[model samples]
Target: MAKNKDVRVTVILECTSCVRNGVNKESTGISRYISQKNRHNTSSRLELKKFCPYCYKHTVHGEIKK
Candidate 1:
């Protein structure tokens, strides 16, 4: 018998359904600032939890690769 192991590096995200309540105009600036911060400093994925302004809830999902 062998132990099962699972590891992941990256996965597709559905960020269109996140509930954005506390987000403000300043967030827009912050997002832009972050992009500029990573322009040449590093190669990291700036994963954002964008909330859906319409649905008023966070509905984003994550799936494991097979």
Candidate 2:
């Protein structure tokens, strides 16, 4: 059987701008995205530019602990 650990793991990406500002103009919550990354490939935290509906713009999204 496969072990608990896997090569690819699920991760949550949160908007940094919204987190720092602590407010969302369009909505009442911060924007978040679900994504997956290879654990072996990315040893460090992942950051990506994604569209935030609450902010209504593209912002830097960083990986957060589950």
Candidate 3:
């Protein structure tokens, strides 16, 4: 079986703008992305520039706690 402390793990990225604006009333949902990262390589939280459908522009997406 695979070890519990694998080098790569799954994480979720959420748009910062949408969350800060509280704009999830009528929209489908907040923009989120599923991605994998190497735990050993990067110990800090991951953040990337991604497209936000709700905001209709590129925004900073930060790693969220599982």
Best by TM-score: 2
RMSD of 2: 1.6
**Per-residue accuracy of model 3 over 1-66 as CA lDDT, tens digit each:** 875888899999999988898876667779999999999888999999999988888999999999
lDDT of 2 by residue, 1-66 (tens): 876988999999999999999776558899899999999999999999999989889999999999
What clash pairs does model 3 have? none
Candidate 1: lDDT of 52? Answer: 42
Q: In model 2, which runs have C-alpha deviations exceeding 4 angstroms?
A: none
In candidate 3, what residue range of length 10 has the lowest lDDT sum?
20-29
How many residue pairs clash per model? Answer: 6, 0, 0
Model 1: CA > 4 A from native? 1-14, 18-36, 59-66
lDDT of 1 by residue, 1-66 (tens): 877433333444333322234444433311111112232443454455544444444444332222
Residue pair clashes in candidate 2: none
Question: What does the lDDT come to for candidate 1?
Answer: 0.36
Model 2 TM: 0.89
Q: Which model scores highest in lDDT?
A: 2
Please give each candidate's TM-score. 0.25, 0.89, 0.86
After aligning candidate 1 to the native by TM-score, how far in Å is the CA of 23 from where it should be? 20
Error at 40, model 2, angstroms: 0.6
Q: How many backbone clashes does candidate 2 have?
A: 0
